[model samples]
Target: MRFIDSHCHLDFDELADNLTKYMSDALASGITQFVVPGISLAQSKSLLAFSQKHPSCHISFGLHPYFLTAHSRDEMALLADLAEQNSEQLVAIGECGIDSQCDDLELQQALFKSHIVLANRLGLPMIVHHRQSHHLIAQAFKQTPPQFGGVIHAFSGSLQQAQYYLKLGFKLGLGGTITYPRAKKTREVVSRLPLSSFVLETDAPSMPVFGFQGQINVPVRLIDIFAQVCQLRNESEDEIAQALYATSCRVFSI
Candidate 1:
C-alpha cells in the first residue's frame, strides 16, 4: 500500500510548525514520498529547506495564481536561475497556473505563461493549479505548451475537461475533494478517467476529506482518498494503489 502524494503544501503554516511529526504520521499511513509546491518566493525557500531536511520530501518552486500580487517582473528570472542552479534538488515547476476565481485573469495568465516557458526550458514537469479557468488554461497550453507534461493538481472539472488534459498528455491529480458526496462531477470524471492518467495528492492543510471535516488536511489522509477513489472506480485497493503509484512515477520521474 505504498503511496506518493503528488501535490502538497508542506511549507504551509499548519504543517510547517511540526513537519517532523507530520512526516512520521504520513509514513505510518503509507505515504512514502511527497511533493511540496511553492506559492511564492518565500514559500519556495521554505519548501526547499523542508526538502533539504527530509529525504523523502521533494520540491516544486513557482508563483501561484492566488498569490499573483506577490510576483515581480524579476521573479520569473530569479525562478529560472534557481531552477538552473538547483535542478537536481527541484522535481518540477509549479503550483502555478490560471485561476479565474481571482480577479486578475490577465495577469495570472501572463505569469502562468512565464512558468510554462521556464518549465519547457528547464525540461521539468509543470504542476498546474487550474480553478474555474480550465478553458483559459487550455488556451494558454495551446499557445505555449509544456515539454515535460505535468498534473492538473486537485482537479475539479467535467469528463470532457479531463479528456482535454489527457489528450495534452497531462495527468489529473485526485485528492480529498472527490471524497465529498457533492463532488458529483468530479467523481464522475474520476470513475471515467483511465487509471494511467490519474495521480494521488492531498494538497495538505487544505481540501480535507469528508471524515476529517474542519480539520487541516495532511498527507496521511491520502489513504482515505485512495480508498474513496477505489470505491468510486469499483476497483481493488491494490489495483488502484499500484496504478496510482505508477502514474505518479511517470509524472514525477521518481
Candidate 2:
C-alpha cells in the first residue's frame, strides 16, 4: 500500500519544525515519496534544503499566485537563473499558476507565464496551482506549453477542464479536499476521470481531509485521501494505488 504525495508544502513553518516526526508518520502509513512545492524564492531554497536531507522528498520551485505581492518583475529572471544553477537538484518548476480569485489577476498571469516559459525552455515539468482560473491557465499553457508537462495541484474543476489539462499533458493532483462531502465537483470529477490522469497529494499543513478537521495535514494523511478516492471511484485500493504511483512517476519522471 505504498503511496506518493505528488504535491505538498513541507517547508512551511508548521511542518518544518517537526519534519522528522512527520516523515516517520508518513512512512508508517506507507507514504514513501513527497513533492514539496515552493511558493516563493525563500520557500524554494528551504524546500530544496529539506529535499537534500530527505531522500524521499523532491523539490519544485516557483511563485504561487497568492503571493503576488511578494514577487517582482525581476523574480522571474532570478527564478530562471536559480533553475539553471540548480538544475541537478530541481525536479519541477512550480506550485505556480493563475488565481482568478485574487485581486492581482494581471500579476498572477504574468508570473504564471514566466514559469511556463522557463519550464518549457528547461525541459522540466510545471506544477500548477490553479483556483477559479482554469480557463486562463489553460490559455497560458496553449501559448507556451512545457515540453516535460506538469500537474494541476489540488484540482477542483469540471470534467471538461480536467480533460483539457489531460490533453495538454498535465496530471490532476487529488488531495484532502476531495474527501469533503461539500466537494461535489471534485468528487464528481474524480469518479469520472480516467485513473491514469491523476496523482495523489496532501498539500500538507493545509487541506486536511474531512475526518481530520482542524488538524494540520501531513503526508501521512495521504492514505486517507487514497481511501476516499477509492471509495468515490468504487475501485480497489491496490488498483488505485498502482495507477496513481505510475501516473506520478510518469509526470515527475522519478
Candidate 3:
C-alpha cells in the first residue's frame, strides 16, 4: 500500500544530503509523498529549493516556537509576504505552536496566535507542534478555529486533548512515539480514536522508533510507525493505510 509521511524535516542536512538514498528506501517501504515543514525562514527557503527538485515533496511554512528568539518583526512580515506570494507552494501554515517545556510562555502564545491568524488568512491548514502546552493550544483553537483544519503533528496527548483537536476539525498525527511500549497512554488513545481523525507521520531526523533511539530518524521508518498504528487500531492494514492516506490528503490538500 502507498503512504505519505505527513510530517518530516527533509530540509535538514542529514536527510537533505542523502535524500536520494533515504527516499529510495522510503519508496520501497511505501511512502510516496512527504510533507516537509519549515521551522524558520531559512529552512522554508531550503524546503522550497528541495521541493523544486522533488515533485513528491509538499511544504508547510511557519516560525516554530523552539526557534522563537531567532525571529523578529521583519521576519514575521517576510513570512506573511512569502506566504502570500507563494501560497500555491504551501500545504499548511505551521510547525508553529506553544511548547510548555520552553521559557517565555507569553511570547510563544503570541507567536502561535499569529500563526493561527496567518493560517486563517491564507486559507490553508496548519501543522501544530505541542508539548506540555495543550491547554493553551486548545484555547487558541477555540477562540479562532482554522477554516482549513490541520493536524497536531506527533501527538502524544490524552484522549481528551486529542478530542479537543478533533472537535476543532483537526486530525492527530501518529508517529514513532506510538511504537514505544512506554507510551501506553498515547497508544491507548490512538487505539480508541476514530480512524478518520488519524494521520501517519515520522517526524524524520528526530522521534526515532523504539529500537533506533539516538539515531537520526528517516522517512522510511514511517512503515514501522504504521505497523504500530495497525496494532493499536482494529482496522486491517489496507484499511488503515487508505484511511491515513486520505486523512493526510484532506488535511494538507496533497
Query: Which one wins on TM-score?
Result: 3
RMSD of each: 1.3, 1.4, 1.2
lDDT of 3: 0.87
Model 2: per-residue Cα lDDT over 1-254, one tens digit each: 78888888777888768988998998988888888888887777677678878879889889888776754567878878888888778779998988878777878888888898888877889898877888898787777766777898899988888898888788888998899899998799999888998899999889989989888888888988888888888778888898999889888878
* Model 3 stretches with alpha carbons more than 4 Å out: none
Please provide, for model 1 over 127-235, each residue's C-alpha lDDT reduced to its tens digit, 9 standing for 90 to 100: 9998888989989999998878899999999999999889888999999889999999999998887788799999998999898999888888998998889888877
TM-score of each: 0.96, 0.95, 0.97
- What C-alpha lDDT do the candidate models reach, one value each? 0.86, 0.84, 0.87
Q: lDDT order of candidates, best first?
A: 3, 1, 2
User: Measured by C-alpha RMSD in angstroms, how accurate is candidate 1?
Assistant: 1.3
**Number of the top lDDT candidate:** 3
Candidate 2 residue pairs that clash: none
Candidate 2 residues lying further than 4 Å off, grouped into runs, are: none
- Residue pairs with backbone overlap in model 1: none
Residue pair clashes in candidate 3: none
Pick by lDDT: 1 or 2, better one: 1
